[model samples]
Target: MMNILNKILKRYGDIYHPHKQVMESLKINKYLYIVLILIVIEGLLGQYMLYLNKDIWGIIFLLFYGMTIAIGSIFHFKYVEKKFGSLEEFDLEKMNKFVKLVDQEVKIDLTNKEQNQIINQMILEKLERENIKEQKKRAFTGGIFTVLLIPILLPFIIENNQDILILTVIIMLVGIAIIFFSFKSILKDYSLKYKLERISDMLKEILIFSLRDKSL
Candidate 1:
């Protein structure tokens, strides 16, 4: 089953060659996540202020948080803008074929040294993928914790009030809904990471063979 992440990669036609663009896109995604974390922190602070009866300050913080999230989510969705992670579609299948093409058992000339260059880029991409995966896992864990702990802990933190209970439930549900989708992405990232590492190892073997042949 192709997840929405893979669908976005294919639908937006960002999977073309000159894959360096994917690297740039990965950088952009990192920054976007940083922005997202900032928004989350802002909202947390707002909620805390409201708990303390600082309603005006709470509203100001929450207002900015909501606006930033709304705008970023809108632009990232490919509905109005270039779409987040748009150029992050590297063809792992093509990369695997590239490794097989340079197999020692096969008779092919290494006329294009760019093969090594491409593989090096892929290693970097794998590192970037690891970074993204770490972020997603963190989000998943944090969301899960919030979803579980909020209900149990909130009652003890504050006096028993119906409104506060309702608010805690709302926050818990939001946490669950938001991070549930990330599990699929986390799995996909692992699959891609494994394939990339295998391809990297295969290319390294070819490089060794090439060096040995040159020495003889």
Candidate 2:
């Protein structure tokens, strides 16, 4: 029993850690949580209104609430990113610091070629790890949204109106498609292999400059 519980905890921890790290790094975890709560409240309120047979008003309210939250969250994210710098910039600074510290401790007798290779390897490893974390995070988010959509659309499915059911199905499909394509785009643009290669190239250039400076 204890072993089973431990395994469960470990599995979930692995799944959750990537997103937690991202939210914390961006310093928007609390804000995002609040937005999530507001969204849930909005959904519940809309559902209640619909149950009360105020379909038009409920939809109008939902649209208004959703738009407000979406716009507010976008602005909030922008402000936070502006204030703290983007996650990419933060990660780059972390890598730079790590490289600087390693360089300081490195023996002066080490050849420039050797040092360059070591730094390149380190950057690649770090970026690759980050890439894995990002992929995991995106997968987790997609899974969550998929699950949430089920309950959100359940009422429409149960309704006797064939037209409403068809519309619901179409909307759900569209939502799923958006999520799918978004994930694909992220994978293409934010691939760990690509980022690692880019970082490696940039680091190599910097290292070359540093070697020249040292020789002068």
Candidate 3:
């Protein structure tokens, strides 16, 4: 059971795993880690207030908790998009060199319709793989957000009046479902946009290489 759980966590964790340069370049990881700690602190405060029967203060703490998450999420999405969209830091120099080397090694008639079609197909395949990665990244972010919220919310609900607790639980389940689906939709849209932007850069390189042999 432990192994299985570990595997599940690993699978989900991969999405949020910053690329090697992500931490160094953006410093987003440090900011996010700090926000996460703040969320935990606010959640604890909320729970403590609820325990003291101060429902209003508890609600305020919870609202602040949610606001912190929302702010962090917005920052994360913007930073990620900015980093991925700007290919300046990307090692395209190496890719260009590789493409040039391949051009030299493989004598392809770029003017031939069939050869041109094959190049297009290869570009499409590259795009598909990138799309898959984008989807996984988005899903991973959503999953992490959902998992973190449960612990924060559970304590307040558990300590409440039984009647209110039952109603809250029902409402909470509905809310969770709504949130999960909403995140899926939002993330999917963002992922596609990000993937398309990156693919455009890659396709430009590939096209430039393919057309190099053709006399205009």
Pairwise TM-score winner, candidates 1 and 2: 2
Count: clashes, candidate 1 = 0
Q: Please give the TM-score that candidate 3 achieves against the real structure.
A: 0.32
Where does model 3 exceed 4 Å of error? Answer: 1-28, 86-216
Give TM per candidate.
0.35, 0.36, 0.32
Clashing pairs in 3: none
Q: For residues 122-155, what per-residue lDDT tens digits would candidate 1 score against the true structure?
A: 5667568687867878876787776776776676
**lDDT for each of the candidates?**
0.58, 0.62, 0.60
lDDT of 1: 0.58
Name the 10 consecutive residues with the lowest summed lDDT in model 2.
4-13
lDDT at residue 155 of model 3 (Cα atoms): 64
Query: Tens digits of per-residue lDDT for model 3 on 92-199?
Result: 543454344434545443334565456545545555765687678668666866786677667667776566766677668767876787678667666544544443
Q: Write model 2 residue lDDT over 22-55, tens digit each, in one string.
A: 5654464456666666777888888889999999
Error of 3 at 29 (Å): 2.8
- Predictions: Cα RMSD each: 15.7, 13.3, 14.1
**Deviation in angstroms for 174 in model 1?**
11
Ranking by lDDT: 2, 3, 1
How big is the positional error of residue 208 in model 2, measured in Å on the Cα after superposition? 9.8
Maximum-TM-score candidate: 2
Clashes in model 1: which pairs?
Answer: none
